[model samples]
Target: MAEWVHDLGGSRGFGPVEVEPGEPPFHADWERRVFGMTATVMAQGRANGSEFRHAIERMDPGWYLASPYYEHWLTGLATLLVEKGVVDREELEAHGAPSFPISRAAARADVPPGAQADPFAVGQRVRVRSFEPRGHTRCPGYVRGHRGTVVRRDGDHTVPDVEAHSEERPAEPTYSVAFDATELWGSEAEPGATVHVDLWHRYLEAVE
Candidate 1:
């Protein structure tokens, strides 16, 4: 499976994650403003959470890798605001703000309740599907094709893979699956180590 720039989990060459002690959430005023704007857009029903994330995934690989985290948020917000016809490119550049007091009365009207049955059970072994999707997916590339034990059933939720592109948010069961480190990272991984991931039902299949 060809990995997108955003799916860098378990990839090599990048340096170790450096943690800043006592780090603040926002580094600048613009980042805080961007976050608030994004929240407002979602509240207005102009966009959904999955749609917002897909917009970031659709960014140019070069710019995506080179930019900071909040910049990605800004880019996603801007893209959705334009695509949803809430604002045009000209108006966005000229005023850099959307009209105030947006409404959420009919938010997520297209999404119906989840009616799917849960097939897999706790402790059941399952394998992540290996197919490549051209659009947004919550499934991480590293877990694809690997077998894992379903540790917990997380109930039904909207499938991000579909919600990103379409207005309808069909529901599906999700599970917390536990995989041994060696299964994903080979023998070099630490002994007795395991990684847990929350995956949608469609991403897994019965291990036969």
Candidate 2:
């Protein structure tokens, strides 16, 4: 049995686990378009579904606190259709594709690489350099310009920021870098404030 854990929003713990293979991959631009549309609807107080709204209302604070903005967008989309009556539980199970569809041309451009990035060795000193911030940045608002050792590096995957925008552009590779909690949050943080953020290769540099 394959059990999946998801954070719906709010303070309650993760809800009943679902058994599944996993979600299919999507182009970065498509994700962005979905997010932008969802935000627009939300701003208008007309989000798509009721179950989605309820899930959003119940999402765990911890997941909500740590997730990227676009992640919230993806989550919202999943919840909305169910609540709105656009899709049913049985329909969801039977449907081959997700509610939002992407063009075939776009799909071809977003395939994952045959090879993946390797994990970082423990205790390696690394630095997070500043770049012209745009679209979406996984580096927390508090961690820019901060120096920290590379606690770990979970590497080479499709960059979510770009995939979130697949409707407009192409998906690219992103690296997941883990930083020591102390480096990002300072000594006042709890014993485990370590944060692992997915960063594009373009966002990093080596420090002397």
Candidate 3:
């Protein structure tokens, strides 16, 4: 079965990808315009990166399939600008393009106290929570409900889960966890194989 828009990773029914090495960033002139506009709006702090991605995620799944890569970015940018009151349909239709000044506060983001203390230390065994989240998340689908050993501590930073919905960037200690490929996949995976994922502390709990 295919998971809809929110549930990416470990889902089925994706087409095979053809990698084009040394490909230019923009394939067409319209792509360049879209990319530049998105970049400018983001650089000006109309919305944060989390909100930008959440905008894309908010798109109808059917719309998502029809959109090309840069089109998604353009959609995200337009959504944020309109939703945040930075721009409106009238201005866009009349002016053709829009730009706004970024606030100083938006430039240097503030950290929220989302983390009290680190849960699992280095070399500790932890299992990822299996439940699906209703909101935006950074956890990869394949790693959920699986156990891994913490190999490194990435310190504390903004949690994307909350950041997507609000202005706050809640802090959480991130970790580099190593999972045996067999655990995440199955015995079908090659023997002695492993995968490393950088996960937030909230996604994991002590295994023992």
Candidate 4:
């Protein structure tokens, strides 16, 4: 599977991480405002976490790479506001609108489905199923088709793929699967190392 530009967990060529010691969380006032807006939007249930993430992922790759971290949040917020009909594109462009609360109907629309039965057990061998997703997915590109052992069951959680584009928050069992470093990166990876990934039930299949 082709890696989405937003999902660069294990990829290379991005250079070293420069840490800003004692850095303030917000660089500018506008960034703080964007954070507030995002908090309010999510608090009011205008959009879910997965939906917001997918909106950021939907951004143009070049723009995404060029933009700052908070700008990505701002862009995702704007996209959700417009898509949810809370604000129109023209009103958003004008940037002079009165604030209104999100409707209760919208908040209550995503009543979560019942919890699903756990399909895989702890210490069970499984393989991540590889598939091309048409929409958002919690399954990362790096782990697809990889064999791993389920080390922990994370219980039921909302499936991101379903929540991203729809009003449904279906429950599914999640697991922390541990993959050997050498299994993923060949002999270059250090010995006695493992990478653990939290994955949903649907992403894995039992390996006999």
Among all candidates shown, the one with the greatest TM-score: 1
lDDT score, candidate 3, position 78: 73
Encode model 3's per-residue lDDT on 26-73: one tens digit a residue.
Answer: 899999998888889878877777777767766767777777888788
Poorly placed runs, candidate 2 (over 4 Å): 1-123, 131-134, 166-178, 191-194
Residue-wise C-alpha lDDT for candidate 4, range 1-208, written one tens digit per residue: 2466777353456789779999999999999999999999899988889888877877777778788998899878887787778877678656743542111122222222333434798889999887757567777777888899999998889888788778766778889999998887789889999999998888888898
Of 1 and 3, the candidate ahead on TM-score is 1
RMSD of 1: 6.1
- TM-score, each model? 0.86, 0.36, 0.82, 0.85
RMSD of each: 6.1, 14.5, 6.2, 6.0
Better of 1 and 2 by TM-score: 1
Query: What range of 10 consecutive residues in model 1 has the weakest lDDT sum?
Result: 100-109
Better of 1 and 4 by lDDT: 1
Give the clashing residue pairs of candidate 1, or none: none
Q: lDDT score, residue 169, model 1? A: 67
Give Cα-based local distance difference scores for all models. 0.77, 0.47, 0.73, 0.76
Name the candidate, 2 or 3, with the larger lDDT value: 3
